[model samples]
Target chain A: MNNRQILSAAIGSLLALGLVSNASAAGKKMDMEQCYGVAKTGHNDCSSNKSAHSCAGQATKDRDAEDFVAVPKGTCAKIAGGTLKSA
Target chain B: MEKPANDSLPCIAGIGLRAPHYCEVLEKLPKLGWVEVHNENFFGGGASLRTLLKVREHYPVSLHGVGMGLASTAPLDQAHLSALCRLCDAVQPAAVSEHLCWNSVPDMTINGPMVINDLVINDLLPFPYTQEALSHVARRVDQVQEKIGRRLLVENLSSYLSFTSSEMSEGEFLSELSRHTGCAILFDVNNLYVNARNLGVDAKAFIKALPAEAVAEYHLAGHSIRDGCLVDTHSTQVCAEVWELYEFALQHIGPRPTLIEWDSDIPVLAVLTGEAEKAQQRLEEYHACFK
Candidate 1:
């Protein structure tokens, strides 16, 4: 089947499953969408936070506090490349 | 009215629609109250956006975000925000949500997806719970809500370590944030369980602290243990302990849209449906009380 046919079948089957009715499916706001890195510690959002689950402990070498780029909202704005809106 | 109109999703359970099971789920159309997906995956539409539109024809899709860290120290990535807004316009999602953690740091730059910004960390990094941080987060959340033209539900983060400079607990911070920004809470049960185990946070107190009416959705996920601390790994099945905590949350906050979140090492469609079914059973028990 073509794309429209495939989508039609999918929506039809979804209705058949009683998961979503045609009325509600059409009516609903019909919405809606990882990593970790250096400067990243045990957490990434993965196994920890990035490594939180998926890449747990990928970067275990603890960096000193100075390695982190995080500053207060004020200082962050003053940094050369830290404009709120990028060029 | 018979029952006060509750705009939240049905009390039944749903699953996180991951890349692995997309074809199967779309083909089979398994029984689920709703389905959620990461917002970044569909940033610039192509086949992925096309598929999501078709999926939208079926299930109630929730736009759950991982990259839009509300507490990030960097300036709000308007490009990223615009991409999210475009996706929401196309999808008209049932609920739009993001993690309370901060991921945007200017240590690196993202080169793709129309993000005209310097480097942003790919991970969900933790932040201190100072008053300053809370104000920053509330303002950022307000920006997102205004852009989306809808209330954004903020999910609590699961961290391995605690910051020494933190002035308040994560739960209290979230409570105050809701009061300030009118943002709803996503209430990830697994994150709370992981934090309780790793950082000695009071799980019961965390649940008690949240504004119940502010909670828009509930997430149940599996985790793994490393060294001594529990990791919020969404790899395995939802553990028994988290199920108990979820039920406890239901008792306290009442039922809302519940989702089973299995991210990495995603299992087959059947496995996710099975987990969703288990949650559905608990929801039935919760719904009986309103009868």
Candidate 2:
């Protein structure tokens, strides 16, 4: 078999053995909520408006715009002073 | 607060798991006594947490925090503590630890009602070793332990400066902190060596002054010297001087779960395992002599 045929056969074997799942399942559905103003300083997960450090554990100040932390869905609305929309 | 008699980490050498080698470690499933990762890195769900969970299946995991800021003068970050507790519930790690340093300060209020700055240094910074600071840190430790529902290992900091207004040595402060709050110490030998070279801290005295029973783990790592100051860079291999210090620690404090930490310019897995094997050898020598 050529490279493409060999790849297909391997994937077919995995599927037959129940070792692989569909694309949606493989994507690991987003069950998280982005809660803003709750991230601790230097612990934010991603980009923020105040400073564009653009990575985890790099937030210079606390509660900046778009410095959201991934929380359980629907949990963000419950935290006092926590907002879904960043200020 | 009553302290646990011992941590659950194996009394063998382990390596600090970093990002570069995650794939290789998972694929190979090498013989590591345990693995530690920074707590903040795996706080939220996604590829990072998923990858860690997969790695967790093979090795006992230790959650070490760098962002808790236990000694911050600002009010304790409740959100951070809650996230940590959630992680502990999920990971069920062998031990959890943080540094004895501060990273936050109260927001600055300018002339009158105008708020100016929200100061939060991302790095671990040292504070004066005074009675007041001790009381402050003790309360915070108690709070963290209470929230986490387990003992927290507080590590000594590698500082570049010392406070002349300080009332005690860092060792005494840690001893008193453990005594008062029942928290354990994560004794970093290289940190002590660095502080000694940088600011004239007495390394042996610091080791001897610690309550040995309260020491639950040992950290061995490499440092770099810049402009006549030894910086705890954790970028290179464990040096001969640090190994001597580790042996000294073994003789004085007895064997504990030791770790070889290389955070920057990380080498291959074999290199880290080689460093860990070096530590394991010394640990075994101590065990053999005692037995």
Candidate 3:
């Protein structure tokens, strides 16, 4: 198979394996080929962001905008407090 | 007494050989009396162990352990002890030592580089030196000696807090433990200095109380200041004050295999060699006085 066909098959296997739990699992689903194309474009756009935080924030915003999931505020602060301490 | 094969630990000074300078040291083969490395870092058979063996060919090696937790309430880690025994057989280290403090508890928790915390976060947790704790540590020390087939040296630890329940001072505890188990002491002069400043422990008295025959080695390292307390950080150059305290220890304790240790933000080989040179100078000065 060509590269595009191989990529499509890998994405199909992941989705079939129920690995993409963060995304919507209901309603009529997009085929693997379509999902792969969308992901590739989204990744290119995210990489252009100035900082990792901006990229992650934009990704979360996009996911929420698409009704993928709810993004909570100040989650980073809570995680930082729980993890950072002296050894 | 007949020295062990490959035994060359000078009654002078040496450096804690770290990964950053292993290649350069092997190539140059600097005029060092001996070198020490953390035993855990070389437990696995890999490049690190390979390099240490190469370095071992040139200088006497001392395996200083930081994770044995001899006083831990938990059952002794048989795997850790086994790894140490295997490394000893392979390296034939001139000496092997562990700290006097406890790092593991009944819950199998640990502290320090493997685990970090502000208080009781599993890393080298200090406890009250009660009679029960002393017996626990003595039993563990006995097990280690039996397993390793050699007398183990235990070093004193630096602490941020003191226990209200401690029945005796740390020096007294160490002396008693040595008396009971026949373990040698790896006296770290910088740790004594830190304890003296932070907890108001009298360093001179502690030094005087120690059984001189039980001392097998000496360690000198730098520490950092934190909120009016001295922390045994071992990052920077050996401070002037610690050097002076080391001189006092040399005078009292007599000549031992002194090691210069710098763990964090390690500098160039020249910098560590320079530090080792300073320790060598001090050891020589003490010898001169005896003459």
- Highest TM-score model number: 2
Which lDDT values do the candidates have, in the order given?
0.78, 0.81, 0.75
Best by lDDT: 2
**TM-score, first chain, each model:** 0.23, 0.23, 0.23
Error of 1 at B215 (Å): 0.8
- Poorly placed runs, candidate 3 (over 4 Å): A1-87, B1-8, B108-122, B288-291
Model 1 accuracy (lDDT, Cα) = 0.78
Candidate 2 chain B: 10-residue stretch with minimal lDDT: B282-291
Q: Compared with the true structure, what per-residue lDDT tens digits does model 2 show for residues B169-202? A: 9999999999999999999988888888888888
The predicted structure with the larger TM-score, 1 or 2, is 2
| C-alpha TM-scores of all predictions | 0.73, 0.77, 0.71
Show the colliding residue pairs in model 3: A87-B116, B110-B122, B111-B122, B111-B123
The CAPRI category of model 2 is: incorrect
Model 3: lDDT of residue A65:
65
Error in Å for residue A42 of model 1:
33
Ranking by lDDT: 2, 1, 3
In candidate 1 chain B, where is summed lDDT lowest over 10 consecutive residues? B1-10
Off by over 4 Å in 1: A1-87, B1-8, B107-117, B288-291
lDDT of 2 by residue, A1-87 (tens): 999999999999987877446654655553121121112123333322223211122212246646676644787778987755663
